[model samples]
Target: MPGPPRSRVSCAKCGEGVNDRREVISVLEKKLCRPCAAGGYYEPI
Candidate 1:
């Protein structure tokens, strides 16, 4: 079965695609991805 419909959004800083399933952060009235919201990318383990 297919998953839920995607509601794609763009991050204010990087313009990365964000979907409804992923976590979205709002800052200063702009939508941001997790990395952007966290102020940087995560280091790989």
Candidate 2:
């Protein structure tokens, strides 16, 4: 059996194209890259 399909999504803030779907983080209903996700620049609601 196979897992979910791997798709590329662009980061909301940096606009960087995320190659791995797992690496993308969801914030404020938006998808972000690892740096944008782990970085302290964005505030949690």
TM-score leader: 1
| Candidate 2 per-residue lDDT over residues 1-45, each given as its tens digit | 266557877889888887646565475778887888788565769
Task: Show model 1 residue runs off by greater than 4 Å.
Answer: 1-4, 21-23, 40-45
The C-alpha RMSD of each candidate to the native structure, in angstroms, is 3.9, 7.4
Candidate lDDT scores, in order, read: 0.74, 0.73
User: 1-45 in candidate 1: lDDT tens per residue?
Assistant: 278656878888889988874656575677888888876655659
TM-score of 1: 0.60
User: What is the Å distance of residue 26 in model 1 from its true position?
Assistant: 3.2
Flag clash pairs in model 1.
Answer: none
Against the hidden true structure, what lDDT does model 1 obtain?
0.74
Runs off by more than 4 Å, candidate 2: 1-5, 40-45
